[model samples]
Target chain A: MNGSAYGKAEGMKATLIHGTHDIRVSSDVPDPVIRDDTDAIVRVLRSCICGSDLWPYNSADDNPQGDRIGHEFLGVIEEVGSGVRNRTAGQLVAPFVWADNTCDFCAQGLQTSCRHGGGWGSDGTDGGQGEAVRVPFADGTLVPMPGEPDDALLASMLTLSDVFSTGHHAAVSARVRRGDTVAVVGDGAVGLCAVLAAKRLGAERIILLGRHTDRTDLGREFGATDVVAERGDEAVEKVRELTGGDGVDAALECVGYVEAIRTAIEVTKDGRLVGRVGVSQYSDIPLGVGEFMRNVGVHGGVAPARAYIEELLPDVLEGRIQPGRVFDRTIGLDEVPDGYRAMNDREALKVLIKP
Target chain B: MNGSAYGKAEGMKATLIHGTHDIRVSSDVPDPVIRDDTDAIVRVLRSCICGSDLWPYNSADDNPQGDRIGHEFLGVIEEVGSGVRNRTAGQLVAPFVWADNTCDFCAQGLQTSCRHGGGWGSDGTDGGQGEAVRVPFADGTLVPMPGEPDDALLASMLTLSDVFSTGHHAAVSARVRRGDTVAVVGDGAVGLCAVLAAKRLGAERIILLGRHTDRTDLGREFGATDVVAERGDEAVEKVRELTGGDGVDAALECVGYVEAIRTAIEVTKDGRLVGRVGVSQYSDIPLGVGEFMRNVGVHGGVAPARAYIEELLPDVLEGRIQPGRVFDRTIGLDEVPDGYRAMNDREALKVLIKP
Candidate 1:
């Protein structure tokens, strides 16, 4: 294949998805290059498996030729295209989405819906879980680190790519104000991060609905005031009892499942907001006229990570927050298959990768 | 039936729903009296047919013994129970839901979800269309008028009971602000009032979606800058084209039908809000993850009319806004059946009743 001028040699190790539960590292994947004037080639220093990646890993149909996978990553820029002025080679940066942040949606802090935006690993773009990635709209999508970050700070900054920003999206969308009581549904990386986000927003109380002791323990340390292992109606009752039967001032739906959304709805008080950042498993939310009439508003979708990265970078740099703790395991590129399996089996909270 | 000693007489003319397409004024109905110390009896002066009332008028099953029907009304206080301290006899006032506004939900401005709240014409409560009515939690539910209003001003003040306040709720919930562009998805009474409300909230542009010329004209008078006579997809397209292909900042769903809500969703820009005050005919909102991911939030429900009356009363009284212009026809107690038919047939925007 004819390659662009900027990046290093062609062949590189990258993760690929062939079929359900089948992920593999391939050496034949082409290294990313400056394919556009606004692009930059990044030598991926760290990447991680996202909870949503498991959806396709479990259900995507078989294809003998695999497709690139993974979206979250931080890296050192290897090259910059002619039009990119904000970034240069060898600079450390975190990338969120492929977005031209000048669009109206981006201007409104919804870069995920940018007019010239798309996800990684599509339309010949390199996946994050690879040796290198071709990042489009470099000036708009990448946030440069102030100085070289230590390994711990690097890992925490990597979360700004998706999870932490997503959690922040939940809290912001729910309009979590100072002294408000919030309920966060789920205890995954995003949910735990949401607890931290709620705390950061000055929430007086955070109730995390999760079953795992290990996850909830971390959640408590992350600022969850109460943990309810119960789910469904029982969870609703437990939250109500905790809130003196008034329900939380706001709720965050971090689990994509319908049951989790229902729980968030049930635990939210009348006239309050329920922020939903989960990649939905169900098409239609179950909110009905009864809920609407009671003024239980449901908002939020995909996190505009690019928009949030700037506001959160300082806190991450200064060690004001420890978002990296959500990543409990690390692996080489070859171990990505095991990483997928471990996450699927609920054995790992998150799995970080070093290519 | 037993009657208390507050009203002029027991038997009174009141509207009843006999079945679908069957509404009648029945003199056999008993006049209301204060059964509780917090109750007050009101002598009915003005009432109006609501868009929601047509739901029962069109679909309610045939019952030889009819039930109480209408809900929107304003009147003079004929008597006040001992415990009522805020209101007194001979006061002209408007009533929303029968809510004890001191409850948590009411305190939070969601009077419709008040813990001890209920609608009119249920559980031995008198319908507002009757000659005289019982108002529970009188201080919490009724807003006293500044002075006796003229016929024109009285018509406008009557709207403060439901339609005007409901319209205000839609605008408020959508968070319409100064210089914002808004779309009102319906040209009914509530829709027209929403246009007025949006204007009052400093919306620079209001696009009204409706097909009726007479109603849309009133909408224009109420401050709609543009009008689209299309429905469904065409309506969405027309509205988008009007707003330079970037949808409205906020949308108000005034029609209960699912199509109107869908239109509201489609015509709203990404990362914008759609406030819905319509009594939804469908159980599930059509907002999927795609819409959610774009940050299109859907908020609003049954308007907390009781809470809004106080905020809207001054403007209605001082002639800064004329929300009462939504009424296109007037009828007497005996002509209530005809009024219902005219409203159902779309021959009247709204019909004011003098009982």
Candidate 2:
């Protein structure tokens, strides 16, 4: 040990939940102590609520006690463990919320379901919405920006923590090839981001199924060629007609509802692909095995945030991507419950919480 | 113009269905008149019943009033139109019952869903299980065998028309790469044939989910490395345990039911593929969007029989493949109803109706 580097106890502040929806601001929570040499502490700059957060918020039985919520964030490194050679204190970073990139599945791009790495906000770990968080496998999880980001870009950068990566994963898993027509089955932040991802990936045409004018405008700005205000079967027919009798080549399922999954399947052509990124609350979906046999490919899982953070960081820093725009509202940490309510009521696409 | 060969009024006998389940043995059906000049008329030497025939047989309201059922056969060519130079009269041939194989989709290996090809049995054309059949696109759809076949080999050769091709298609669509662990989710003839196909495709481990001892034994004989008797979640767990908790790399879904589709998803690991060959009666399935995001690929449709018939005929002729052994029972044409009943009751693996 280097004697010159005197020991100083690390400290962090986090939000804790006592029971279902009972979130409390706990400032004196001990800062995360580095367990592995490959860990680092990050001072969260901006964090936001995710759609998955609503699951526990809405379910009284599943989430017995108020649990830590939120999983997306942009942060700055406050301290580093001995083995973490890639990041140092004061460096701005964004880390994938789950997954270590070295796993076999992660290497194959199935990082969301990584076999060895995963962390939920309820696990007593620092949630992304908190002021400070601990990240393990720093080298494989965190990506540093070239420089400090301005306030305007921070929220968008924060979106990369999960939603952007998830949207990208959905598009990739759906096999959105060049010149392909794509349909996005949700209008949430992730769905909006998926529209952008699809455009960035060069889909020849993009169809967004959303009724909200603001979201629809964002979708169009992101390169959506058409918007279907109707939903379910009617939406499917509209997409089919837009493609001149053939269905879209790919579909991004961002809402984990049965109807949305069906819509994704219905709007896609034979031999096409559907990337589903929603956190499914229901276990059973009546997927037509025969219809899928007509050459449809379904793929998507948890977003491997770590695998994409690095690749997307530079783009965000260079202003090539604008994912943060999905955050229609930003508020102080205390207003989180209201943000949650607004999102639940579909009044906001995403809510950014600044602690 | 070839005037001398053009004006002959050649008549052929064919089995026609005038209404739902009303199959008639028509002797004076207009001989398949050559329309494109690339067609050939064959005197049927052998034809067998197919599992798909039961769809119309069992349906109470949806069955077409008049539609041919059989789509598997071997025959001797009696006449060839002007442009049909590939097969001469009296030549023994096996023809794909689908359509002309020159379509773009067919070239891309999706012949079953070909843009220009009509599906076998679904098309109201002459059926294969008859005294004589007219085959269009003779050069592309027909495969000439080595020499005259023995009786046993003829029955086996008849399988090349549909079952074997379908099995091969399922295996291929599942992306059964070399050294992969594979699971067959059905015990039908197609499933048994899939065992052979998986073996031929170099699967390192092949597990068959079945209950019948006879089918299990046949599966083992056809290259099933393991047999799982349990169904549903329990069976999925068994397969995962056998593959060291990772599940199989590829799965063949030959049973078209909700349970079978669920079983296929449950038994595959991340980054694996599932090929579904079963015609699903139910069009909607509850898909676990989150689970699917982990990277399971689903791809399969109707089997492109015409595409594989030619490629498989050589192997069949040389005795390198034994797909025909899947037929556990054989009956005369008049016994077709009993065959249907036995199959519907799950009492027979496959029933080959000889006409």
Candidate 3:
């Protein structure tokens, strides 16, 4: 099929943010094109609403004109620019970020901090929740799949673009190892994915801290050995009690809220670590003499999705792990507004966008 | 010889804090005794003042009656209570802290947070800078040396009780590995010791951020490959320049001041860590979006000195490393007041108190 088969004469359909709590799918946005020699245009197959997206959705002020908005997607390459090597047109690919992976930061497994990198929906770059995206640094940013995947595998692959990789980063940052006990703070898609990540890293016991039975039930399927429905100091006490008053060996903070971060820190054993992969909503970390006395430290920040994709891809391909279970609902690009509301209101765990 | 040979009939000379900038050696403090079955009386051989001590000295109000002080010391085991096993009388030993090292915290190498732990000079417990100290958790807290060490070796062993071990904690927490580049902030005794610790960990290049020529000269001798005598933003820029504009793989914050911690954080490479072994003087950590975006993290807190002594002792005993050189002056117990003044005034790098 020709690339234009997915595009309208003058534009393409895409998700745009107009104002607080206002999401819209506009069909007047220009279709993505390979503007740079190192770029590739990908026709998006799947996209999803992220918990982080709700941050701006809840508070950002009005813009008379809308701006493009999503970041996670898996797509098929429709066209490759002249200098794009290694990846070709017609390949199925996932772009972690528009990063030049050859930079020093990327060389150190920190693709998020790449000197020549940027995010989608900025500087006229097309967003993921659209008909197609213009991927920068094509050869360095896009991970091409070996073969076409089925629907289930495709959902799991889409998570490789962000959430699953972020959860894995939390596990890695917390230094979860064999025979360790871990506590994951949050029941969002990221937290559920972290349960699978901890299990993959050989954690002997995994605790899920969430009140929702529906989400907690899925967390159990992902390998959480225990669940605590309490909140605040009560949650701290309950987690400590469960760990025999010693606290878990590691804790993962998947919710960006201040209280969630504090609870994660509290439930971690002395001399251990707390991995905070949540996009922080607070500006300061409460680190005082008490935390210092226990030798507890917080480590994780932005996930280097590009660096982790290759390592996690094999398991997803062989059906050993399915992070896609996070997506409990699916809708077309036109339903992007409802998807955002469903996610923000906690009505849907995660809404998949089949554009 | 009897322990009484080192003590007076009614009391023993001990360093006490009276008011701001006021330190005194009183001959009226009661001699230490085996207060519990887990205790032992150690006849003081050597003790030293720490950087943290100055925090209170700079601001604390008057307490005319005076309170016992000092925390780091090495001595001969004078007497052990019946329950004290593994350690016997007459052995030369170092006490990192009065900790029951068998507790879960100690087992995890977080002796500072041990369930049955307490520092010296509180609740009638004898201070280190005295004729003798009532050592709690004798067998679990004391590390016995193989044989009698000379004056030089004795000073190094004294360092194992705190400063040297604390410095080692900074390097370890920062994940300093072979072939890595490291930056150490501060020019205090602990900072100088950190340079040695980084060298032992096989850091390829070591940068010391300090303005003091005399102290930095010792840092160079202790393995600092480069010295950046700049402060604040200038120091940050200089460190980045030294590391090829990429910053260092690890940065150690040995000074507890806010600016020192911030500098350490700024000079660390993206995705790397800053190990803060400094006794935190600030109440909060400035963790913002920029830090999160770069994936920079801060780890480390109080040093588990007891846990590190065994690993670092062999190197000290074999003469492969000399950490005692940080002590630029030596004094008798009665001169403890002058020792504090000298250190506070920057006239002394460190003062060793021989009782």
Candidate 4:
């Protein structure tokens, strides 16, 4: 593994997926190169495993040996191309996903839908799990850190790149108004982040649907006023019962399972909304017409994390929120496999990796 | 069937669904009577066959014998129980759906989602396609005519009962803002109404997706700026091409068919929304996460027509809109069977039945 040397070099180390349940960290991976004039090379300092990464891990694709992956990371700018603006070397920044902020979709705070946007871990883009990343549309994709990065703030700021902002997106899309009754379905990091977001949005009541005591404790600390640990139809009934039979005004679907999706819908009242940000483990979410016909609308899809980084960064920097708590375990670049195992085995709510 | 007699007598002619493809005008039908204190009997002036009626016509329900049907109607009050208020004999009015406005859902302007609400022709509620109809929640269900009804305006006013308001619900639920581009995906009467609604909402551009020249012609009159007469994938591609490869800003799915639903989703750009009010002929709309993960959102369901009656009644009364034109053919109550046949056979856009 090249003596596990952690420094900028001609070659870098990266986490690569060989196939389902097969992950590897290679020290001899190629270093990033700017492929676009607007691209910038970032030396990833901290990264994390995402719930969505499980998709590819579970997918049985033939010959899927190497596919660069990981969408969440905060890093220092090491190089910038001629067309890149608003960035310089040694600056710490967090990028949501790869996007050009000038697009109409980005202008409307939907950067994930940017016309020129693409996800991390693409064929050429540097995946966040790697030591270095080539970020396209550098000016739009990265938000400059408010100040020097600190060990205590790195995890929180890192979340700004994905989970934290994604949870905020769910709340915003659900139109979570002040004093609204909200139900968040899921106990993952995103779900806990949603609880925090709902609290930030001024939801008077927040009901979290999850089971693990450890996760629920964090959820409570994040402002979850109620917790219903039941699964399936019973979970739905418990939520409805908690809401005085009127159902919550808004619901956030953070788990992609059919039952979780169903419970989210069932716990929402007529003329309400269910904002879903979870990339489902299921290919299709079969929402029956009965759900829609009741005047309950489903809003929200994937989170446009890039659009929200700037909006939420101030709160994180000023010590208003501590989203880094989601990173229950921390490891170094050599331990990327361990990070994945911890998350996959449910031994950790989330894992942070640093190089 | 008894002799066809007109007026408030021992019996009145009513359209009854006997079985699939079997419709009858029975004069032996008993006159509507006040079953609840809040109920008021109305002497029907105009009514129409709805597209949804085809659901049962295509189904093989055993009770295929008889059930009073038809929801769209405007008429004059014939009598009211002692407890009834806001309605009196000879007063002209239109009811969206049979909803008790006092219900929590109605109070919130989602009358269609009222807990106690039911569609027309259920058990005791008066079927609009009759000489007289017993309306429950007289105060909430019926909207008083803005002025004395004129023969030239009855058809337009009748539309306020269902199709027009339902179409408006589509535009409203889709959150169509003024000066936005919108696509209406259907050629049915309700689709035409959606065109009018989009126009009323001040959309800068309106595209009608349909293959019918006759319907598209009326669509243009209703403010459609473009009409793409294509079906399936070709239709989606045509819309995307017209929209600069980004797809429409908002799409209204007005056809319940799977192809139409698929086309609507495909023609919507990332981060945009598709509002559907079509009563699905299919049991479920199979939407893949791949569609949603791209950032396209789907909203709208069965429109709450009862909630929009008062808000839209003014525009209709001022002659600013001519939704009545959607009714390409007019028939008497006794000719309801023919009206159904005409609609089913695609010989007319909509059929208006007057008593």
Q: Compose the digit string of candidate 1's lDDT tens values, residues A223-297.
A: 999999999999999999999998999999998988888899889888888899888888766667778777888
User: lDDT tens digits, residues A43-90, model 2?
Assistant: 888888888887666764543334555678778888788987778988
Cα lDDT tens digits, model 4, A1-355, are 1212323466889988878777788888878777777888899989999998877877736455577778899999998877876888889999967889998988988887787888887647778898889889999998888677687699999999999988998898788999999999999999999999999989999999999989989999999999999988898889888888889999999987767777888898888888888886555444457866776766677888888887898889888999999998889878877777778899999989887
Q: What's the lDDT for candidate 3?
A: 0.90
lDDT by residue for model 4 over B44-120, one digit each (tens)? 88899888877776673555458898888998888777777677888899986778888778888888887777878
lDDT of 3 at A102: 97
The runs of at least 3 residues in candidate 3 whose Cα sits more than 4 Å from the true structure, single-residue gaps closed, are A1-9, B1-10, B61-65
Candidate 2 residue-wise lDDT at B307: 73
Local error of candidate 1 at residue A141 (angstroms): 1.0
Candidate 3 per-residue lDDT, tens place, A148-188, comes to 78899999999999999999999999999999999999999
CAPRI grade, predicted model 2: medium
Which one is best on DockQ? 3
User: What is each model's TM-score for chain A?
Assistant: 0.98, 0.91, 0.97, 0.95
lDDT of 3 at A101: 92
As for model 3, its CA RMSD to the true structure in angstroms is 3.1
For each candidate, how many residue pairs have backbone atoms clashing (under 3 Å)? Answer: 0, 24, 0, 0
Per TM-score, the best of the predicted structures is 1
Model 4 misses residue A226 by how many Å?
1.9
Greater-lDDT candidate between 2 and 4: 4
Model 4 TM-score on a 0 to 1 scale: 0.94
Task: Give the per-residue lDDT digits (tens) of candidate 3, residues B168-284.
Answer: 999999999999999999999999999999999999899999999999999999999999999999999999988888899999999987889889988988888899998998876
* RMSD values, in order shown: 2.4, 4.1, 3.1, 4.0
Model 2's i-RMS, to one decimal, reads: 3.0
